[model samples]
Target: MNSAKLSHRSPTTDHGSQAFPKELASSVAISQSLEELGWIPRPKLLALRRLGIETVEDLLTHFPRRHEDRTEFPQFPREESDVPICLCGEVTKTSLRRFGGWRKIFEVTLQESNPNALSEPLVCRWFNLHYVQKMIATGQRMVVFGKPRLRGKRICMDHPEFEVIENDEEISIHFRRITPIYPATEGLSQRVLRGMIYRLLNELPSTDAGLERLTPSNLAKGERRDAIRAIHFPASWEARDAAHEHLVLTEFFAMQMLIASRRADASIRQGEKHCGAGALLDRLLKSLPFELTAAQSRVISEIRHDLAASHAMNRLLQGDVGSGKTAVAIAAMLLAVEGGYQAAFMAPTQILAEQHYDVLQRWLDPLGIRVALRTAARQEESGPLPLFEHAGNSERQEPQIIVGTHALLYDKVSFSKLGLVVVDEQHKFGVAQRAQLSAREPAPDVLVMTATPIPRTLTMTIYGDLDVSTID
Candidate 1:
């Protein structure tokens, strides 16, 4: 969350919420050309533009990735420090040092900003980053943040985030209280970006940010204005988290609203029941020498209910390696076949497709279920895929089950009566590829399987329209 940016508007843009009030749009009118700002030099302005910060919104929204406390200063490092420290210092001397042929380092000698010298000047080094040489000069006051270490006799910090202090006003902004450390580019410094935001924050009104509250005031305390302020310069970490909580909740609520809308659209189209009496599925189960695990059996029951329903089945199946997902999928396919229709099983790669084909044939051949394998390699070696050579006609196609890779998505491959589609490692395919098999007058049940565990919160947001069933 860009705390400074949050001060400008509600999170409507991020989560697909409704447009903000006109008052909010007017607030960001400061997005005029940065050329109007005299403090940033012409070269640094070009660098900022390259980082996509021409407008004021881009500048403010270019949020800080972190925040550091600068209320106190640490002494020059005698040894190395694992954690990063923020320091205010003056550039005592600068030099371009040479090492291995063609390799160079830009070195800056920084003295403590305070008058009384306590230790040796810190040696801040930038190796091979050519642009740093142009920015740093001897006698320039600056603030730098980085982990310090002793390099030979010198105390050194490599590639530290440094900002040249320009004027008296910026000294307090860079030194005291909580300082925002922005996401900086090679040529940009954290101090410069923070200064720009500090000025912008001072210009904007300290109001509620004109946000239409997504959550109740009772549920999340504090106004949008307070939250925005805390994000960039909070009094404490607790304050920042408190300020950030409501905004996070608002974004999440907007996402759920979108998910509900998508779910409603999916339910509008009535589904055709492609499931038949359990004879075919039962036959396959009886043919197997082993019984289904308790988890697999429970998942099968959930899928069976969806297949028998009038609404189209949009479900995700998750199981670990060797968790019997193939068995559940076969059961689903058998049900579709029993209803006098065909099924398609898709895998992400040719090798996986061939593996599934070999297994399907071994199990289904005895039961007289004709399984066909189609892949790009096979299509090149052999002629056209028989299932869709003359797709409109059914008598010419003999396979009750077809297994293939992305080759199944070709226009030539159409199921005469597609009842179900089982996609393994479904995340590898695009939305269109996954849904292509089921896009017909009578929608086929789609069971997408994945071995990768997706966070439950994410599934609710990203795959919100689909019903989720897991084989533990």
Candidate 2:
């Protein structure tokens, strides 16, 4: 939950049954931001953002890919089996040995305090991962999970799922159950992420009152709150699965609600139904040097149908690189022009805007359509932009198709009609920027195009509000 959602108690919950007081619960929500955590540095916060983790909620949602079962350390195996044994002890001897000219092996000997539990010290070995040598310090607690081989009376494990336990608290957290292993980036270590989550959970309000206020109405008050905590630090596999089910269902329900809301909005909002493909579109296609691929043709047909409807088109056009997305976008923009309304094409970068202007100008210039570039780079080079240049004149002038970056959202930039908006590299732009551009016109048809192809399920989850048309 975000800070905004955490502050209030669910109306469905009875205030008398709350576990914690209101003041303490409010303190927990205050630390929702990364900076508020106090442990993370500025550099680390930036790195976390690169991994798509900006808030406490984002960190919690980063579920584990798999778990490490370290509930008990078994005796030296007498026979080979599939299950790997888990051992915990302190590193007694650690070194790097060269096996060949190019190969190096990192070896560490873990000594258990309970001498009677083992015959001798267990030797842990790693290959190629040189960082393991520096990471494993002498006298540090480590829990190694791997298939052990009886190497000449020495119990040795090769490249184990090893963890350097910091203290008694960390060991308790790590060995409590099937431990979660989160997906991580280069600079962001799993240990660091896990510790941060643990600290947050520790500080969070655990009282029934605090949880009742934070949890959603649909979810069971105490049960849902426990599930959220259990996901990060579960006592058993059964508990983890039960917790994960509720969270997964929550995500699915959220997507369903979003899609339903979008459908409801579409039904209520009125839009212009542009005329069918005419001379401008046909001539533009004929003028092209090559033929449109079947994928491109199919997507264009889908777009044409959306534009002809009596509602604003909120569609996402996804295509792979070199899939002729620009050509399809141009054809969609022509539908707006044919209806005697202006259109705007917004790109993420000025360089891309200039490139689109060059391509679109060549195609539409002959048809008497004025295509203009209104980027920050172009405005600074050639004095005032076209919009400002025509400001003082009695008659306001605007391009049929204006191509630019964020400059399109400026106050000086105005459109006569703005029937359609085509945003290239839609992921590069923020939601507010896209909204501002579309807000320029009165419920203009939106055709967001992306060059990078995404999986259908993911696309639906992320961009579920918009209609999807893929050219692949």
Candidate 3:
């Protein structure tokens, strides 16, 4: 609420500097100094931070996902069956065709030579990359790395890493070895990004005294950084492999360290307590037509335990369609109401919110519990009476349940005593939006419900920070 301090400011006056502000540098100076005392040179430490890397321990954990072997040119004729191959070749010719509206295809002729016979050319064709045609001329040599297939009399390479080299002289005899390909973004080509990283590495010497080595000994820092440099602009495959190993190790380590830190932070924060018997929950469950499955009961138990814990609950309940995720959620709402706190259910779509409102009101109305529905359509729908227009006072008076789309989160819709926030179909909401909803006054305990059943491994990796309870 402090507008002056929190408001955004134009950076034009302070935008000229290439590095972070001196104030921010001072803020981390003590940590940087401590790292220096621990044998981490200041230059490397700063460089790591510049690359969004922090902590001496963090430097040791970054690792690469995979490696590319560029040592030997695995020509189409020589490629082994079922073996993944990466090689550089020349694009001898290119042609383009417009199939239909805004659809174009490119045909390219890639020349792969036999190591045993340098003069012979094995023609390879690539399709659908019309932009590549503009980059290739008749005699230009290029580096093409990917899987190769024998198509009729000729070999074809699809979606290959194709790049133009300065000359045949640029092709090193040692290029037939392992290389690493880093994750890259559009507009920022891998080659261009690598060049930027190389330039940053070169600038390390001029950085603060305590910062020096970007990668620590626990990782093959030198090799990986070099591999990153070489794979993008490699003279040989061997150099690329060495660089890849180092890079991969560095990336993996960084991620592991970040996870470890978050886990530690969560351990320190205590959860909230909303403990009670299953009386209200049983009533709600018995009210439904179907009996509670063993899986649903187990997830409800986990959620109940979270609600009764010392720290605020941050849980995800995932289930498939018609799997009774909503039943479990309704039970949780009852528990919140029993504990004398208001509950809110937010849905991504207005139609879904209306459906939830109808279900909740039908079940809870008999129990004399106040249930309100707020939606964008509340102002637009034709009806005998507009409940909102006739409510007299805008402020909520009773300890009730409010079900709606994001309309419930409006500034005017303040709760008397907010406790739990149940977000249905969380994937439809942005991460920041969910956080904002959870941060509502009294800082409600969060229960995210999703119908899509994501794989366990992916869920753990992507939503590891949140406590998960799957219905399936």
Using TM-score as the measure, the top candidate is: 1
Q: Report residue 227 deviation for candidate 3 (angstroms).
A: 8.5
Write model 1 residue lDDT over 205-260, tens digit each, in one string: 43534433666777777665455556666655666577668668766777788888
Residue 177 local lDDT, model 1: 58
Model 2 superposed RMSD (Cα)? 9.2
Please estimate how well model 3 matches the true structure, expressed as its whole-model Cα lDDT.
Answer: 0.61
Ranking by lDDT: 1, 2, 3
TM-score of each: 0.76, 0.65, 0.63
Model 2 clashing residue pairs (backbone):
9-213, 18-209, 19-207, 19-208, 19-209, 20-207
**How far is each candidate from the true structure, as Cα RMSD in Å?**
7.4, 9.2, 13.1
Worst 10 residues of 2 by lDDT: 1-10
Instruction: Give candidate 3's TM-score.
Output: 0.63
Q: Which one wins on lDDT?
A: 1
Count clashing residue pairs per candidate: 0, 6, 45
Tens digit per residue, CA lDDT, model 3, 229-297: 344434444444555566566666666677667656655665456545767777766777878999999
